[model samples]
Target: MAQQFVDTKIKGDKVVLFMKPTCSYCIMAKDVLSKYKFKPGHLEYIDISGRSDMDSLQDYFLELTGARTVPRVFIGEECIGGGSDVVALHKSGKLEGMLKSIGAM
Candidate 1:
């Protein structure tokens, strides 16, 4: 599973949301994004609880982005940081532009 997920070339409009299912922070982040009317297919949710695949993915995510938190996002191979960063970008009116630039919007 880990290998498959990692190897996956993320179809069109790449956006990944790495989070655990029960994490409120994760849920909030996703909710906020949804509230913005982002389409359902705009993001990929990788849940990391007891799943080894997720654990491995988390490790890779950390190594790749130097972040050790849930709800870390990647837009088209670009690390967009964690929930706070994402929300900050949205509040600053930069999120949409960034997404658009990356062809994720």
Candidate 2:
């Protein structure tokens, strides 16, 4: 079920963030991404905190992304890592290009 949810959410030309509302890393990632103008419905935040199946979801994330960390930022169908990673990408001027490629900006 978790797999299905994640797979469906990340399948298209969208930026999907699997995050917890209170996570500092998640906040950082969100702050960076929010600087951009995404097409409607192109940027999605799936809050994993307080969910009954959160552990299973994180397990699936570990299997799929090699990490169970929040702020799992996906640019289109790619897992672009966590908050610091996103900041790095933004600093390098590659995040915008990525968003542009997926038509999210």
Candidate 3:
């Protein structure tokens, strides 16, 4: 439920990272975000497999993002897609800029 996601971890931050625990791409995304100084409190990660609320919320997230994949990110409620997309943004040196623009980094 939305309330559950709000209660668990993603509600406060402007950028949320929906990721799985054992996913390599997810790990890389986290690393990249950290390397860019996104910092600890600036990000949120959800493991859909472990939490029932997250599993249910994935549908809503997919509906918003139009992508059924882990590592679906949101910056100020803007859906930013999966890992490859995040990596691409980072590679282009635009990811950090975007975070800065949003006052998230």
Task: Choose the strongest candidate by TM-score.
Answer: 2
- Poorest lDDT segment (10 consecutive residues) of candidate 1: 3-12
Cα-based lDDT at residue 80, candidate 3: 79
TM-score of each: 0.79, 0.97, 0.81
Model 3 C-alpha lDDT per residue in residues 36-100, reported as the tens digit of each score? 66655776666666775665566776666676678777776577788888899999988878888
Clash list (residue pairs), candidate 2:
none
lDDT of 1 by residue, 36-90 (tens): 5455567677676877566677777777789667877777777788878778888
Ranking by lDDT: 2, 3, 1
Q: Which stretches of candidate 3 lie over 4 Å from their true place?
A: 3-13
Q: Provide the global lDDT of candidate 1 against the true structure.
A: 0.72
| Global CA lDDT computed for model 3 | 0.72
Per-residue accuracy of model 2 over 19-71 as CA lDDT, tens digit each:
99999999999999999999999999989998998999999889988999888
Per-candidate Cα lDDT values, in order, are: 0.72, 0.92, 0.72
Q: Number of clashes in model 2? A: 0
Counting clashing residue pairs in each candidate, in order, gives: 0, 0, 0
